[model samples]
Target: MKKYFYFLFFSLLPFGCKDTNGKKPIEITTNDSSSIYLNKAQNKNTKIADKLKYYKKSFTILKNQENDSITRSKLFELTKELYKNNFEREFLSSVNLLTKLATKSKDSFYLAQAYRSKGSFYKHQATKDSAFIYYTEAEKILKKIKHKEGLSLVLINKSLIQFDTGDYTGADRTLNNAYLISKKNNEIDNLYAISVMMGLTSLETKDFDKAIQYFNYGLEIVSKNNNIIGEFNKETCLNNIGLSYQRKAEQKKSVEDYKKSIEYFKSALKNKSIRTEDPELYNLLTDNLGYSYLKTENLDQALALFLESLKIREELNYPNQIVLSKVHLSEYYRQVNDTAKSKKYIFEALSLAKKEKAYRDYLNALKQASIIDVQNASTYSKEYIRLSDSIRNVEILSQEKFARIQLETDEIIKEKDILEDKNRSLLYTFIGVVFLLSMLFVVRAQRARTKELMFKQAQQRANEEIYNLLMAQQDVIDQSREIEKKKIARDLHDGILSRMFGARLNLDSINHLDDPESVKKRLEYLNELKEIEQDIREISHDLSREKQDLINNFVSITTNLFEEQTATHSAKLTYFMDSSIKWDLVKNNIKINVFRILQEGLQNINKYAKAKTISVNFRKENNELHISIEDDGIGFDVSKKSKGIGMQNMISRAIDCNGKLDINSSKENGTKITLNIPLE
Candidate 1:
């Protein structure tokens, strides 16, 4: 399985920080011992122990200082230096220091970068599980901030881990996602990394032509950088392309495809700059090209390349590459029919593969040994089968472990979303409850206010009724006093005074007359006295007599109200009262309330109905008093319940009179209010 590097693409986005300036962004004060030590520690020429001592001294001073932007930036500077120099333990400590400073400062960009750096360190240690965890954490932060370049690189690293676990499907999907994100931002470095990852996935799946296409695409982008990194990546692409063609050639048994593979491998080695810039790539190409030569029967060139690659690989002590080089050399000797030399190289390659745990290459070595050593061929073949099964089982277990990791990460994200949704729901519920409580409070307050207003209105109506009663009583008393005075004056003038006058005249003429005339005069005078006394008694009786009942009071009051309405409003009105009804027989309460209801109805007609003409009719029907007040005016809809106080007053008064009131009106038909009451 091939692993891809992605952290280099951090330069594409502002949020994706990288120390491309070769030093800290801030100036270091030379007055401080910490600054001087940090500067010396970052120097490439410093000894390893000296660098560690300086870094430790620098971090001691940094921990005492506040975690600010400048401090965190300096920590990042040191971390980048350690990471570049492959100082694993020092790099981890620097990453942790940066993380502490970034957390204290609440700097998400620096925190994510720290996480990515830590992941990169773990990847170097071949700790894929820890590397994937840190990369995922970094990705979570970068994605939220829309740091496309950084997220793309982290995703590529995760995909590479998937590739190592034989999760080609997961790797291809993640690689495509990384490719799209980088493509949107036009980030060339991230695109190249993802393209290479996709190419490796294709190569693993044996889609040789498709893998070559992806690697070729990566080569085009890397060729523009005229540096060691660009040259290294260029060789990687060319070597991977050659591998794809060589696999295709072996499958098809085509000499033509093999030549194509040789052409690409030779091109990768053509630039001598690559040999010195990236010695491992040069050595790898040399071995791979020699293997292709062995396939084509170019014995001289093949032998020379194989020997040179083996010497360099063994000197470097790279067991995996050394195993490959030795295996190729063994094959070369076998072709030349040097049986003893071939067995020697093949045995050494098998021993190294087992020690390095390079099982794929070990299987290859075992298969080669089984063919070369005929005496122990069965033993070699049996070992090959068992080792192949063990490797396959390991690959399956790795895939399961990585799949579980992916599932757990997805579950955490899902749980976070659910928690957010629940929080929102609780917020909305609280608001709804508060709103409902407020509405209830308002309704109670409104009800209290309405009840108070109604009580005051009832008191006012009671006072008005008392005042009307007093006025009517005063008018009756005034009319009685005037009648008494006129009657007294007429009795005195017509009878009492005239009789006294006759007595006085008689008394004066009887003075010279005899006793008989005197007696007659006295008698007459006495009679006159008796007549005056009788007249006084009659006058007293007349004064004590009850006043005449001239007309029904209910009719009089109703007529007076109707007259007042006509005079005040200056409108045509008609009022008819059935003379057959006994006003005296009706209870005063009924009369009073009916009168009030009629008064309210007429007032409503005057104030709102705007009727051209109105009629008030009172009739006795079925032992009930029927009163109808009609107004031919612009009317309101009868279907709608009226909220007007005037209408409510009329209805209430009618109910008080033990009557039913019906009001009908429409725009086309003017308003008519009818009241029916049991007269009994």
Candidate 2:
């Protein structure tokens, strides 16, 4: 009954957003009887729809069910279906529950998969920072589990995000990681992805021939396969190859390159049904081909193609593509000697480009403005040069970030990033010096005013850059601190190695030539000896158990932390413990929370407190245990309104244990933090 109504509703109701959607409306269809909704949702053959009714049903079922491995598998499928069907709200909602359930199930494989899915979600949202963080998380887990394919996919995702942010050098290194993984696995799909992305990186860096070669390689792989993936790759390779040629022509004005570009564009659009099948690509191809025709003096053909694409773009209401169409149309008019029409279109294109942030189109408009608007040519030329130089500097900064590429560790990336940052700063200084020398003789009256402003701006920029760098490096710094904890755990290997070897030797010794009575007696003796040995080991373990409890272990841990911290700073650190405090009687939960809070405090002090003396004390008073930390460093206002995660966590931890916590700080008096947990 629902199926009959689903088809009937679409037939009777008006198609939604037909003019602006570009793609045709989704047809009501089923891919499979079982998992029908999910299957159809992920089906490219069905176009796209939210299918909120089915989504809600899935979410309801998930909420009622136990979050076991089977449930996790089902949830993961729902996320995929939601993502593929363009249900962003539901996808984000589902991803959190899926990850939490995976974590609860204690399944590393599914947990890694969940994190990667989250990264994909954020990537689609264009939230690169969150996406990168999640991908790094997934990378750590997948690497530990030795899941090559999952790691490869995550790296590919990270590289794509890097490429989007203009981090071409990082993208190259990241793709190299995926490439190595793909080569090891001998997976054609993964290889195809790497080759194409590498081509894009090369293309962006202006290595046109290398880019073309990569596209050809991708094309070769697709031609030998007959899957749906191949069809998609074939079109992508054709368009990307065409784009590489188009860019080369734009750079060098090579007539042969433009001709080659036209051929590829025509090839990509050879299937006549593409206009209806994929109107978006059809529009892009038409616009690109028109531009190539305009470049080659085929004015009549160029004008018709431009008009067709322009009509399509306006109907589709894609402001970015509309700006692109207008830019191309302006060029067509300029080539035809229609100066007024060219001016009109270029000005409109510039306005729309600014509104849409279609920077490439904006540049094109500016360039055309300089040519067609003879009276204002100097102004347009100056604006064009300034924007172009700004873009170039941004690109340089991004590339310089990973100039010393080492993909082995986050530490390497951070260390190399800092080195490149210094290099970039020096480069800026050198450029500023050159500019200053050149400007010294340029209208002496304005030079002093200009220099002063430049100095102030430089100081501000330096401060901003420093803050941004610190924020970006926070994750890597946290990872380094975690290594300290792992270092302590790794020491256990030495104690267990000899015992494991002895046990293995005893197990391997079999009495092959013995009489039955003698073999049985020997086995009994061996079992008795093993039981005695285990009993001895248990006694030894229990004797040391108290020393490994949360509080005692914390004391030992903090000793190492304090020594390491003070050795690197000028501050003299002192820690005193109340010997009368009975840690064995206190719950581990309270002890763990206190330990974490102290760690956070020490970190903050190391980062922001330029203290000469730091005091950390744990004492018992009245009917409660008291802990206080005092640092004679520059302190912030106690009454300031802000969102600080560290402070919130400390307060929450104290509340969790029915404790009272207070923080007192002032600029003149430094800072003090106190915590009181009741003995009851």
Candidate 3:
């Protein structure tokens, strides 16, 4: 394990690690060569407290080298150490190197290595989008290389990225892929990493059994290896196993595993003290210590460790880790009932998470805030439900958006194929048409010896020309009619509708005269004139509006006839319609059909038998027109009355618009006429 550090250090010696004059050196000793001197100098320097300093020096050197496979491999190792140590500056520097190196290398192995490094860096940074970018890039390269071990690493990296990105399903798939690859290659160390990632992925998804299985598998391998990497991974797996139980609501079992995991983390932290080269591991263990406390519900202890971890993170200027600390602190305060303080910290965390688009941290903060609100049960229930629904909606929308995008892509490909097929068909048709025309022209030339043939050709040409002209003219006429209808409809509604309203007002004033008989006669005449005026107004409006054109003046004429029928024919009239809508704008044909039908309806109701109670109603819906008129007179069975001309005419009008006409009547109840028409 320690020998691997030498390989990494040497790989990074060309960048900022300079000679005496502070200039980049052209040639430098490899990490293997430098190890001997480093060991000797360690005793001499005395203050060379950790391996981090050598790794940091190595990282600086690699940053100055032009992007290449060697630089990527070295920087990847360096960054991993930096991430583990919580050396943010060194970690960032190493990531920068890897990103640059990746762009310059066509070698899939190098690209995969660089991308894997980048994924790790962003994972620590808590930027899911950035991490996903790197992980996907690494996946592509690993796929190209067909290196099972390398592919496993890429998959594990991707799995962690997915977990952080709130793609639990994707994380599970990626972790499983890594596990399968590790098993296939018989790579125990690779399997160790894969298993740990798989365990964490399952834990996050609350699959306790799967998480336990993965963790136990990883723990066994780590026990067999008995190395620092293996030991650290094993502890992480244990911690994750505990989290799984907690998520499953098995709190007691969770606490037990958490305590054991903390012990392992403490042991790992001790590695920094003895190795002088393991600052990265020290920082990682410290962070994990805080996390373990949080998991165990030791809020105060968790807060203290998180604060301490943050101090190191801030010193390193790690933006992502600082955000994480705020989140943990927020959770601590929330758990302790410090609502205001929790809110402040959590909002700060939320702001940073949103700005960085860090899905993992954002979800964490959102969940904590939601829990805090739950204390005010009555007050916060609605808010809690709203927040919960919003989170679920966003997740569902994201999944749907991805699915929709894929579906659209598939559609586009299909459309392209269809277009290509159409183009080919068109080409063939054009060729056939041209060939037929050519043959006809040739035959015509031969037949030109006869005047009859010439005359027939002229007639055919003339007919074709006339047909084209008529089609063009029809289009022009339709457009002109539509425009005229709109203009006329608007003009008549604004003009005649106002006039009729004024006329009705004038007639109402005349009703105030003192002479009873004269006043009654004048009012009766005014009412008849009013009915006529209304009918004219409706007709004008229908001519202008297409909607009214279909209605056959049902709205205008029905109420008038019902009122007269009640007054003259001794029937009671009841009309119901929503006053909110402008009835005159109903389709003209519909209005006319309904008006005529209503006229027939009133005649039938009046002439049939001695009765009262005539009712007319007009209703408009989103996509259909409705008119109903009923009379409580001597009624007959509708099927028996189907032979009536009025009924047949009504039925024909309804069918013209592909509508439905229902005439429901019984001998004693009433005669009801119902017409429904689909509207454009």
Candidate 4:
């Protein structure tokens, strides 16, 4: 009987607690389902690993295959999948391969795809600037090719980066572009992401009702799609909706809204798809739910949920989330009249918040401490108010930054449109002139009259070209000045103002404390202020250095042109400028004309001289600026090409600068050009 009972127990163990192999059954609990979720996640990761292995093998094989459009497309798809799977190194390798193949084949489609993939990689790595750059490049190509879907995708990615960088208005504009393309192409996924980002921006600006509507729209899309990823997005929408409700509740102090927020959070948490795919979201929902519970005065449930949120954050080792959880826990203890526990948790939170520079949490802790400690309430409240004002100012500054970005983007778009229109008008005018000239030539073939007319036309064209060039140069100079001004403004706004604000807050806090630690903190802040002053001096020095560089702009331009000439042509170049020449004293028109002469001369050399060696010289002699260029090549006969357009232009440029030009060239002796301009 004893043996039979033991056998029965052992046999029933597989169905009861232990499996046949003696391992415990996978347990699912309402309080903690982390183990089961992790197991499922591990299984999914294993599958991803297997898929990555297959992809790697296939990628290697495809690399050896013929580099055709179809083959390249397959490779890009595989690389994108690698990116999605978080195979970062492998994705980069594949991107490099695609880039090389595309460049070698001159395939724009593959190149655009490669850029998009690179952007996705950077996006995954959270390098917003680089990701934005690559996405912009991809968008340029896609727009050129009129690839509607690809353009929409790239724009969406760019908008996401803009959102991350706090360019909320700019993000909205970018998303609008993507929205139009996606709507035209019926790209549901792209539209879904755009809606969510729009909602997030609205949420950030406290447009709760608008945010809720956007979230609901996104949720409706996911509901229609009904895939695993769609379900995950649905959960995200729900969570965001809950967040909006929670904000509304705080504003209105409505217990009903808080209860609604808790319900939504709980519903989002119950979605099994989110559990494995986004554990961080799970933690966030839990934390928000805890806050909602606290607002509703459900003390026991709030405490339990807060502890759970803290456990998840601790496991993830996310400092920000952990600090937030601690703050909530401290608030909970305070509400429950547990003074000792509240003080302990508040102090812990304060330390972490200060270390993280999370001023909001730090201020919250100070307020709580003031209430509990009583003796320091006035000091704590004063510091809290000061810090609050500083934070509000910073928020205003950030909003202004977003507005500035929006304005800049709008200006760029307007400028682009104006340029396009100008180009179109020029094209139409050119066509009309060509038609008129053809009729004139057909009707009147008198050679001398024709020659006179042609000369007058050429002179008119040259004057127009010169006027346009000067205008462009002036515009460039103005733009550089504007950029410098903006840089100085940013330094003041982001660096000096922020540091001074921090110092003021610290000073306010110092008056309340008499401890050695407080004195030490005050000294540290003073040192920081000194460092900030030094930084200001450094920035001023940088500005001065830039001004000096601008003063030598002539030399800089000449050097850049020479380097470009040497890089593009087979010729070796030697260039010299006399150190004694005061470039800053030269009039702008003189400098521009001299630069143009050099440009025309070098262009002529490249086209006609076939130069193997070139030399350029600039100097001042007898209160006159002297410039010369010489080339050792099979020089053209200057007598035959004396009336050439290039030579005429060079002479005209010199004349415009109140200078004289001399050209010496022969087939056997090579070529040399010289210009002399009076300094006065």
Candidate 5:
């Protein structure tokens, strides 16, 4: 025989703000003086009917005066608040008022809000299709405005419908969207609602661990808030956590989990907030606690709890809940071997379930009845199987429809996002195009001024060129003398110094020897001296050869200068010299001037450019030696900034080289200094 555990499935209700006058009410406390304050507050709340009548009269008076959108919207909002406790009649009236305000104002926000309120009203009436239609309409407008809070509420409402219709997959997807929006907006109430719904979804999917986590998180939120809805959610989460433990107990056959489930359920029932605010949840906790006791074979405690739950359900006249209670009682009687009482309770449960058309309840009742009704057990068993199959098929159909609607809704939202992105991109692109056009005009004007300045500077450059040539020749001469001195110093250190030391050692050794041995060692030392003299002669020949090989002109001077410049700074310098470029063929004056230009460019890069990398490329193209110096550095505006002395010197050197000097620079694009010289 299968044992059934009753679990509470709490539905999330929309929480509304209570409208009040701008005065703070007296605080209600546990003291005797506070009792009078609490009584006055109760009496004030009791006059809600009179307040509603006054609001209607005021609304009618306001409608005659201005008929303005703001005034009408305010009245609509006031009327909506007055109908919070009234479900069907007053809620319908609020929906009408909202619709009228939306039409008059022609505002999408008002229209969307109206649709949402209508959806809520329809949802409360259990007209799910109408509710879905209204929710979808509201969602369209809310998504258009990117109203996350309203969209989240709509999603939560739609998910509830999906959940009730047994579309767990669809409901889970919808709730996930709602949860993200609520979390992002920090909508605590919506977050509490979504979290609890997610727990229930987890429960349905048999994901007990996730269910427990979600329930605990929701309970934490409720504990901090301590409002009417918060208290309700707290009780709901408590009940859900107990249900989770019960399932875990059943799965693992754990006695400890059952005891824990009982503890949570009892705690939920004892909670003052839950006890005072939520009778339904209180009864659910009682029934769940009884099941937990039954799991541990505490029959007396189980029976007493079950009887209390049944009494509450009976008083409330909730047929489904009453059926659940009777079913549990039947199971309890069967456990204690009270065959007649078990049969009696099971029949009563079946009658109630059939009246309510709760097929699951009816099936459960029949299955239990069959256990005791031996002879007619097969008939009852067959009927239960038939009903279960029918219900399963209906649920499958509902899920398919729900999934299709969800897919369409998601696609619509995706398309809206795509459209928004495209619009934003187009706007940015338009702005960029306009900016580029303006920059083009500015660049053209700058180029014109740069060309005029370069033309005027050309004549002055010629005079500077002659003076630079004479100075460069002297520098080259000085560098050559320095190179020769270094070579002579190295030759002396390696050759003359080594021979002198060897000769001293030989003499010292001769002193330690006898007369004949000393004479022999002296002769050997003399031969070594002769060999050293020959080595010295060879060194002189090598020096002449090195002088012949050395081309201490433009290429050599430029390479040496580049090395020195890089050694002094952190910037990296790279130079490329084409093998085909014959440095000897190039005129000395031209080479010197080209080298000077390159030196000046490098100096500028080191001092002002703040460059990381600089490259110098020397290549012969069509009898022209092309020398280009480039740096990845912060460049100056060639048109705006006047040429400095260094730049003028570089231009003068290029003029003396009989080459064209082209300088390309921009603020962010770096600088390229190209000097094209004729080799022929």
Candidate 6:
């Protein structure tokens, strides 16, 4: 039969050189469930050491395999067998291989499953931090893939590890997330795990109703599966459920579940030949059963179970468990009035716990030991307080070390993030510089075109200005000609024409006849002479009014110039003058030049001085008419800078008008120019 199975195993193996070609050797088949069953059929020993050795040897061979999905699946199947057999070292290797293969294959579902298995293994081994890391990694991956079943399994595993670490709130929080996902996907196994976690957390928090509900649900699942491990786990949940009830003062119900859990555990022990068992699990059930018996004052049965658990823990070489069993045994002896035995066990527990640095267990032992003799009780009480203080100080030191480590980790992460940000910023800056160079080239080309357009605009403006100046000069010449013509015509009509008409009247009087008709004709000729004199007066008045209108138009042009300068520039302009200026005394040419000078002064004030206040003053100062324009704004060095055409024109106009223009300006003060012209 061995030769036939060997043939089958070799047939399953891929044929290749058993070396660098990555071909799996034939030894892996011995690590599978079929081999275990074959060993059982042949009635072999199946010891833990032998099983562990076989799996480890098999892993060496499997790693050389080409590692396809089929090879990965075979490895995972072998992992399940090793895990069940509790081959810790080989089990971890198999888990790692599966995880690596799943990642390499890019199979998220398989990777998540491998992580869950590894985390659960760590949890069973009591390594909570490692368990939580793997569980969280699996959860994040499964969530992204929308693998609800895988996500629920990871969450339930995380919740269990949280419970073990005494984090009841965190355990319940994770259980709630798992419960929602399990319910959505109808995952019975994940739901069972969630219910068990909830029951345990509620029991820890002293919520008896919630604890019982969840425990009952978990027990129902175990009953359906009829799994020995599941049944063992259900007993633990039931025991906790009972403890919760006892804490709540529901003694009757508490006793019922405790008795039920004990009965189930005793049945589990009976079937031990067919099923693999953990020494720790057996010790837990014994301890809890002993506790239940002690609570009910069943001393004989409690003592028996406590001794059994103690012997098992001692045989397993678990120091903490041994200390715990000793402490409980001491309590049992003290209750039975066996003072010597009680003191002996209590001291043993204290010494063992203190040696192991198990401060909590030491404290519990001290509390129990204090109850013996009154004198000893007081001494033990003081010792307990001293130890408590020492333990607290040690915990504080541990916390500071943990905090320092965490801070260093955060700083490292921050530095990494800053480096990443600098890299991104450099990339953006490179892009921006490239864009700016392109834009600069575009702008340089555009600027050349703009310069050409500006040259054309300057030429066009010069031509326009020359044309406007000629038109203005023509207007002035035409007005002068019209004025002279009117004056000449008026002189003829008023002086020469009127005098000639009077002479004609005198001649008519000399040639008069001695009849009534001659007399009437002479009267009519005198009337015509009077009408001609009136016409001459009207023509003279018309010429004088026209000359006055020309002067007014010149004043109007200056007013408009001032308005335009004020509106268009930043300067606030103010023009104030007496409505009745002695304009008739000023010659037409002088009036025109005065108006031009004021217009230029207003323009100069706006351009040179960035003034907010500009004022044009036109008032009579004694016998002189004074016109001043001032700006309460920035003043510059006028003498240092050459004057522009506008400023030169203004000075020239003042000189022509016989106006003494005195300018006073400073940088700190503002510019004020005064024009003093004679008003005689």
Top lDDT: which candidate number? 1
RMSDs, each prediction? 34.9, 31.8, 24.5, 34.7, 20.0, 33.5
Candidate 3 lands at a TM-score of 0.36
Of models 3 and 6, which has the larger TM-score?
6
Once superposed on the true structure, which residue ranges of model 1 sit more than 4 Å away at CA? 1-36, 100-107, 224-230, 421-680
> Residue by residue across 1-680, what tens digits does model 2's lDDT show?
01110121112111011111123423423442324655545555654444666665667667677766556666777776677667878887888888888787777777877778777777767676677777777787777677786677778877876787678778889989989997897767767777888888889889999999988987787787655232345765787788889889989989899999999989988877768866666787888888888888888988999999989888888787787788788877887788889889989999998888767668878998888899999999999999989877866654554342224446755676799899999999999999998787675878777898999999999999999999879978998778544422322221222223333444445445377765775576477467546644743454423224446676676576578557545789998989887777887767766765676677667667788899999898886889998999998888883636566767877886899889988886878989999986
**lDDT per residue, candidate 4, 1-680, as tens digits?**
01110111112111111111123323333232322332343355467656666667767766787887656766665665566567878888988999999889987777988887787777767675667667776776667667776787777777766665556777788888989988897767767777777777777677888988888888888888764223366667788889889988998889998988988899888877665676677778788899999999998889999998899888988766777888788889889989889878877877888898877668777877787768778988898999989977765665565456446655666787799999999999999999999988976877766798889999999999999999999999999998677556544543465456657766786779989988987898899798778768877866533233435687886787788677546889999899998888988767756765676777667767878899999989999999999999898777787575556656766786788999898897899999999998
TM-score of each: 0.57, 0.51, 0.36, 0.48, 0.58, 0.44
Q: Kindly report which residue pairs in candidate 5 clash with one another.
A: none
Better of 2 and 3 by lDDT: 2
| Better model by lDDT: candidate 1 vs candidate 6 | 1
TM-score of structure candidate 6: 0.44
**lDDT (Cα, 0-100) at 381 in candidate 5:** 95
Please say which candidate is ahead in TM-score: 5 or 6.
Answer: 5
**How badly does each model clash, as a count of residue pairs?**
0, 0, 35, 0, 0, 0
- Cα lDDT tens digits, model 6, 409-524, are 45666786799899999999999999999999999989978998999999999999999999999999999998667445434533344335444744465565768766765676
* Model 5 weakest 10-residue run by lDDT: 1-10
Question: Cα lDDT of model 2 overall?
Answer: 0.72
CA error at residue 153 for candidate 2, angstroms: 2.1
Put down candidate 1 lDDT per residue, 1-680, tens digits, no spaces.
14222222322322243432223456646677767888898788999889888887887777777787767767776777677766777778778988887787778877888988888777667788888888888877776667776788788878877887788998898899888988998877677777777888898898988999998998887876443233467777888899889889888998888899999999988889866766777787888788788899898999999998888888778787788787888888899999999999999999999888888889889999988999999999999999888877977887787778778877887888799899999999999999999999999989977998989999999999999999999999998897566446534432354445545656666757778768876786788688678767777777311111112376876786688677556558998889888988987657656765666677667657878899999899899999999988998987785556556656766776788999888995788889999877
Candidate 4 lDDT: 0.73
Model 3 per-residue lDDT at 594: 58
* Pairwise TM-score winner, candidates 1 and 6: 1
